[model samples]
Each structure stands twice: as C-alpha cells, then as structure tokens.
Target: VAGLPNNFVFAQTGTYTFTMVTDPNNQFAECNENNNTLVRHITVTNLPDMRILSQHIAPSKLNPEPGEPITMNVSYENIGQSNINQQMKLKLLIDNIPVDSVYPVNGLVTGGTTTVAIPASWSSSLVGIHVIRAIIDADDVVNEGNETNNEATRSFVVGSSANLFFNQFFASNNIPAPGDTIILTARIGNNGDLATEADVSFYYLNDQLDTLLIGTSAIAVPANDSITLTFPWKVINNSTVLAARITNASELEFTYDDNRATTLIGGPPQVTVVSAAACTGTDGGSMTAVVTGGKPPYTFSWSNNASSQTVNGAAGSYSVTVTDILNRTATASGVIADSNCCPPCTKAPKKPSLLISGMSSTGATNKFCPGDTIIVSVKIPDPTACSYSWTVPPGTVLLGGQGTDSIVLALDGNFAATSNIYASAINTCGTSAIGTGKLNRGAKPGTPGSITGIQDGLCDVSGVTYVIPTIGGLVYNWYFDTVNTATGAGIITSGQGTGMVTADFTSAWVKGVIHVTASNACGTSGARKMTNLKPAPGKPAGITGPSQVTAYQAGVQYSI
Candidate 1:
C-alpha cells in the first residue's frame, strides 16, 4: 500500500526498497511479469499512533446551588489511521479515583471523534471548590499516541439556596376610623445563601370587600436578614382590611404562601332599630337596637325610663339611642297610635340584599374560550323597586340590561386567566352587599424575554458560557447553532434543561442563534437571540514595560 503504515521492523536505521511479487514460489503463473511484481520505497521507523485528543467537563454553574445537577463531557478522537476494536474504558474520576466507567469503544475509526457526557447531582453538604476528572482509556487498554494526555480536570463551587419570604406586618393604629391616617408596616426576611432584592406591594379592601391597589416598594435585603417597610394609608371607609404582598422576588423561594400578610381596621359605626312593634289599643310596643360598623361592645339607651333600648310603653311615643365603644351614637324615634286610627303605619322599607346564586358560560363545559361570549345573570330582586349597578372586569362590556339585574359580557382575547363580576343594589335606604361571580380563562404563563452574556475564554481553547434568561417554567430547553443552521439544520447541541449553559461557540463563532424554550402545564414559549453571537475582542497587539524607573533607600518611595 502506498500510504499505509508499515508493520515490518528493520534491525538497522536505513532507507530501503521493498519488492512484492505474486506467486513468488512459482505455484501460480501470471500473464505478464511487468504487472505481476510491484516495488515500494520504505523507511525503518516507528509505526502510526492513536491518542486521546482532549476532554472537557461543563459545570452547570460557577456557583451552583445545593441539590443542583452538574454535567461532565469528554471528547476523544482517533488520531492514527487505525481502528480501535479492543476493549477500552472511559472512567469518570473524583480526586483521581474512578467513580463511573463507560464501556468499551468498539469501532473508533481513524479521524473519528466522539463526546461522552455524565450527569451528577450535588449534595447539600457539598460546599467550596471541588475538582472533577474525565479519564479516557484509564487502564491503558489500547496503545495511544500520547499516554499522558488521557485525563482532563475541572473545578467548580457549590453553594446553598437563596430564599426570601414575607415575615410579619404591623399597623400604627389597627382601629382607625374613616378619614384618619394609619401607618402600616411590613417585614421581609431572607433565609437563604445569597443577598437578594425583594419586590413588595400593599393593598386595602373596604367593608364592602372592594380591593384597592396601593403603590409598590422595591427594597434590598441581605441573606439571613430582614427589613421592615412602612406606608401611610388614609382611611376611606370603616372596617377596612389591609394587606402586604410580595411577588417577583429575585431569589427562588421554597414556598410562596408566606409572602402575604393581612390585618383589619375598624371604621365608624351605624345603629338601627332592627325590630319595632307598633303600639296598639290592645297591647304596648317594644323596639331593639341593631348596631353595625365601628368596634364592638356597644351601649344602648332608650328615651323612656327603661335603661335598655328595648322598652314597653303605652300608645303614645318613644325613642331609642345606640352607642359603640368609640362613643359613636345613632338615634331613632317612632310614633305609636291606635290601630283603628293609624291604618297599620310603619317606617320606610330597607334596602334589598343582593346575591348571585350562579354564573354560567355559553362555551363548552362552562368554560370560556378565547373570543367567546360570556353571559352573567344576577339574582333578580322582584318588584321591591331597587336599582342595580355592576362592577365589570377590565376589557368587559355590558351588552344589555345594565340598569336591570341581568347583563351579558363579550369575552375578548385580552381577558386574563380569571374574570370576576360584582353587583350591588341600591335604593332609598342604603346600598346592598356586593354579589360576585367568576369565570376561568384556562391555563396561562407569564411572558418570557431573552438575554445574552459572554463568557471568559478563547474560541478554540475554552467554551463560552451563555447566561440564559431565567423565566418561571417547569422545564427549560436550549438549542444552539453550529453552522448556518439558524432555521433548518443548525442544532448542534441541546437539552441543557437549565437557565444557563456552557458550550463551544467556535463552530458558530461569528453567526449563531441561541434559542431557549420554556414550557409548563399551560404551554411553551420560545425565546431566541435577536442577533448573531458577538465576536470576542482580540488581544492587544503591542505591550511595553514601565518607561521611568527610580530606586530609593529605606523609607524612600520608588517610582516605575
């Protein structure tokens, strides 16, 4: 063979010509002598060799949190024109001891290269820096071009989890009345490994259960520490409920329910006579004071000689007064007359109480699809003569019967995951309690954005780390381009399953797209880099030493 390795060995170091002949023993005859014999020039030297090219281990993160998984990858090649059919083992070692072994390489042919990756989990106790090693053909099963280049090692650090939570809330005055200002304070704690920034928000709801959005506050909280926030709320209604909520935290938390706290504040009180028996010719009359609003422990005083608000008197006139712990009082008086002269007289009727028994959807299975019409019918109060007003959700339109009890809503595509409707009835007396109905718009996910970061390393020597945008997702997948495969054939490696990745960018150095897909129970959203990979800056072309140098004695300064 012209270019094949010569297996024969010569005793002396010299150049020689070797001749080959067909049927040298004359056992067979050839048609022509010129074509039967072939001669080749040969040199007595070492044979071709096969070796391990290189190996690499990718640490998922520079400082990975405890319990996070890390991966190790090794790349090897057959440098010689010989196939490795012998049994060879690629062993993964920790501190030079084999921890895992990969099976025999059966058909590693010439110029062939392959990569082997192993995944390992980090324990909670695994802190500080640790070294990982990937050794190919560790037992020296097959002869190689270079025996010293079989193992590659890498180091990484693992830390604990960073968790932040809402701790407690305090109000300067819990029983603040309407038109009064109360200072509300909330506390946030970080029981985690690293420092983090927390996003905090405040909310308030009146006695009617109508929620109001207060402004949000952004604060920084160090690890294993806590901070308190304060907000001044001008009381608008009595019996108001206040809450402090924290969401979109920079650090991942083990639980989210503890991120909110609530407290209730008192308001002005209202008193009314719930029951009043009219005075008649045959019997006396009695009345009881019904009190609402304000704080509890109320007191009642009747205008009659009786100490209590409930009193019995002859057919003349009587009055009652009600008071609360806050000293707020209400008075009401009624006239009693003979039944023959007064024709069953009484006070005006009270407001009708509103209630929503049920809400239905026209779509399939009571679920509203995108662009579907949702019809909400409130419990209609009969001929009592009361007006109705509905609090519609954002982007909802009342089609008909707005002043009436029933209304229709045309659901638009921008409808959020949940839609709520509140109805309140009002008449001459007072406003009724709010009635509510709700509908679900199915599963949904928050919008995700893409980001990019360059890693420290050269194109040919070390891999570049891309800091993937971390969006809330049940699972994450990353895809990178190796060539012009931006659209069709570019996927070189993937299945990172994390928010960050370290890959060889040399293959797609100048032009590439890193596409990340985030998926959950709802669906998936794909994020792609807006532009090609940016080229790393080259090293400085020239360098020089310090121009001026001066030496000094003890206690004297030296300049360079």
Candidate 2:
C-alpha cells in the first residue's frame, strides 16, 4: 500500500473534518486519483505529556554549609502517548524567580527525556531554608496530557555554622597615665568548619556603668583558626571598663549565649574595689569592693583607668585614689606577686609508648606474622606538644611514622624472632626516658642442624635423645614422616618449650624422618627434618666381638 504523507497537529479535543484531494492542481494523474479524493474524519485524543522526571541538588545533603558550591541537576521526560514535533522550553527558578531557561535541541518523543545542570547562587551570608524549582515545557510549545506536573521544587537549609567566639579581650596598657592611648585587642576564634566574616565592636563603661562605643572592625576568621583585631582607645577619664564583642556576623543572627563580654577593662578599679589576697598566676582570682569609710555614693578613680569595682592587671605594684560623694580623696598602694609568675615553664614530657591496632589495650602482647605490617603508635595522651624517637630491630623495615612515637614495621619471613623497639619523647624542656616495646616475630625458622644423638642411644630400647639449637622463648614441636610398610609416630617425652626433648621411635620404620618446628605468639615455622632415626641396634648382634676379646687377652678378637 502507498499513500501521500502530511504533517499537522490537532490542538483541540473536539474532532474536525479532514479532506484529501489527488492532484487538485493537476500536478499528477494516476490510477488512484479517484481514491485520493476521498475524505476521512480522525479523532485527536492522544497528546504529549511533558513532566519533570527529577530535580535535586547534586552531592545532595539535608543541610549544606553556607557558601558551599552546589549545582541543580534536573531532568524532564515525555510521559504521554504522542510525540512532540516541536522543541519546548525548560525554566529553572530559585525562590520563585526564574533564573534559567533552556530549550530542547530536538523534539521530544514519547518517553523521551533530557537533563540539565545549573550552578546555584550561594553565598556565605545566605543561611536558611531555600527553594529550587525545575519547570518543563515552560513555553507550552508541546501539547501535553497534563500540565500540572511539569515543575518540581526542593527546599534545603544551609548548615550549622562555624562557632565564632571572642576568646581574648585585653589591652596593651591597663594602667595608662594621663594622655596615654590604650590599645584594645580582641581575639576571635572559630572552632567550627566554616569560615565567616564579622564585625567586632569595642566599647567602654564609665563609673556609673554608662557604655560608650569605641569603634568597630570588619575581619575574616577561618575555620579552626583565630584572628586578633585591635582598636586604639584614648582618654582613660579617670577609669572606665573596656570590652569588645562580635555583634554582626555574615548578616546572620548568631546563637551564642556568651557572645558579649562587659566590664573587661584591665587593672583594678581604684579604692572602689577593696583588696583581697594578691593574685597568683594568670586570671581567675576574684575581688570585691567593701567601701565603708567613704561617704554615701562614693566615686573611685584608678590610675589603671578602671571605673568598675574590679579590673585586671599583670603582677606588679598598683596604686589608686578614691573620693567620697563630697569630693574628699584618699590613696592606697598594693602589690601583686607570685613565685610561679614565671618559672621558665619547665618539665619533660612522659616517655613514648607503642600501641598496636586491634589490641585490647596498650602494652598488650602481640603476634606479627611474616610479611606483616603492623601499626605501632605511642600510647600517650593526644594534643600534647612534643616529638618522638623510635628504634627498630634488625631485619625490620620501618614503613612510616619515624621520628615520632608511632611507627609501621614490616617483618619479613627471615626477620628476627624476638627483639625490642626503643622510643622516647622530646619536648621543649628535655628528652624523656627511653621506653621499650617487645616484638614477638613469627618468622619462618631455619632448618635444624643434622640430627645429633648418641650412636648407641639411636637404637637404644629407652628411645633416642635428640636435640636442636635452643631459641630462648619458642615452643618446639617434633613430628615423624611416614615411610616403608609402617610409620614412626615420634613421642616427645620431655622439654617442649625448653627446646630439648627425648622421643621414643620404638614402634616404626628406620627410614622415617623426625621434623621439628619453632612456634611463638605469631605462629609456627616450617619443618626442620632430622633423618636416620631408629631404635638402638639389636643388642649389638649378641655381643659377638666382646666375647672374643677378654680382659688382658690381646688379639683374641673374632667374627661371628
């Protein structure tokens, strides 16, 4: 059958008339001309349905870190009965805003699909629930079975941010005299995994706790690092509390409870704070003001520029002047001292020790087979600032972790059976005592020397006494090889771990071989064969030679 082909699409659901004319302009005259003139009505119920197959963030996670680079992966497919003859558009949206529009290079047929990836707009400051949407056939270029399922939306939150903290708040000069500038420094520490930027604001509080903003600084702090910001503050004004805080961080509200510190000015406030015991080492000593001799509402002024009752100062001599409400003044002097204020900060670190992985506890006995690599580490407290030294035995290769407490030792088949590993800890102060770790190598043992036994004992009824070179701490197992019409099951009578033994070979063939192996914690070695073992010769052939040779009868020897 043959027919003329034409391309057209019915957009509406209702059916319409269709007419065909053969050579309407007399372009061709054929035998089927009358049949081509016939008209037919066709129903257009099947339509193309373009739908979003999938839309998500690549390297998907429930919550990604702020400013983390990410891309949106989206795909669309035609799930309808009919194929689309024209290209369609795909639109991507972020938070309901159209950010990207793409077109299919070719028409989409039934079950045809395409995918696209778009880089997302991410910023360190944007930290919250976000939206990503993928819309297929956005231009409605292709007639579909359903249009409602053309888009997909996803929402995700930017992670738990880095923990930024104000670790240090101090000043260059706590007791600044008249016209002296106090350099205030704030140390910010990030204990989290994300870097962030923030503004650190400095302030000061007067005697009445009246606060004043000194200045603000914008700085960047990296993950697990710290940065210091400084601000020059002048005018002690008799005494005032100086402090700093991280108020704004990446345009996000920080959830730290202790983000702010106040009344942190250095040096003790004048007579306002009554002296207690002198402070010892670094901070942590407390003092309270017990003003009884002054008039009502007394005001204290300190050379350290402290308006509050308490302040911080290095170990040294301090003086302050106090005034009553009526303007009467008095002065006092005190000293802060500590023997440990600075003692060269001494003491050597503890000795280095080794710990093997998979062991129950440190210093536990372990076995290492031939061609085995073992992870040996210093079983000591971590985060300790120090170095280490390790010493390995002969025939052992140190794989790594040298010049440190831990190490990797590769023991070969010919490695020594027993040895010790020496190590030590070195610190700024001094080197620690050398430590020791034992190695019980399970290397293959060398073949035993030729079987040594008394010639007469070899055939004795009491069995033969055989021995091999004794290795201090290994177990020797002896066995016999099967031969002839029978076999000899050598019975070891004594000295198993002692390396010396007596075996009874009375029940088997003379052609059998006695083999022994050395074993330790690691495992057993290969066989060391001892051949020519047999019971004592049959009573020396009834002592025929001895009968002819009597005592003092020379030349009386005879053969049987």
Q: Which candidate wins on lDDT?
A: 2
Backbone-clash count (model 1): 4
Per residue, candidate 1 scores C-alpha lDDT tens digits across 1-560 of 12222235454323689787766677766676557678887654221233443224554554566667655666766665454544567777755655677776553676777776654443335665566777777666554445566777765556754556768787798776678887888888887777777778888774345578877889888888998888887777556557788877776554454688887667566766644443232233565666677644556667754556466544456677766544666777665554432222133223334433222222134455344555665545634324467778875666654545666676665666777888765544445667777766644333346556552223343334556556432356566554544433232232255566555544335545666666553346656553545445545556555545668634444343
Candidates' lDDT values, in order? 0.58, 0.60
TM-score of each: 0.26, 0.23
Residue 528 Cα positional deviation in candidate 1, in Å, after optimal superposition: 70
Residue 155 shift from truth in candidate 1, angstroms: 31
Question: What's the C-alpha lDDT at position 158 in model 1?
Answer: 65
- Record all residue pairs in model 2 with backbone atoms less than 3 Å apart, i.e. clashing: 48-144, 239-305, 267-312, 459-535, 459-536, 460-536
Q: Please give, for residues 1-560, the per-residue lDDT of candidate 2 as tens digits.
A: 22322235554344677787756887887766566576787655456677774333332453567777555667777777645546667777767877767766345677787666654544344776667778777866554557688887766557665667878788787556647887877778886666888878888765455677878889888878998788888755534556677866773322354467644333332343444443232332334344544333455455555544454444455566666543556666565443232223267767666676522111234656655567777887323324567788886788765554567788765667677888877655677888888877544455555556643334324435778776544567776675522443455544444456666545343545667787654566777776655554534554355544447766765564
Q: Show the colliding residue pairs in model 1.
A: 50-145, 238-267, 239-267, 485-490
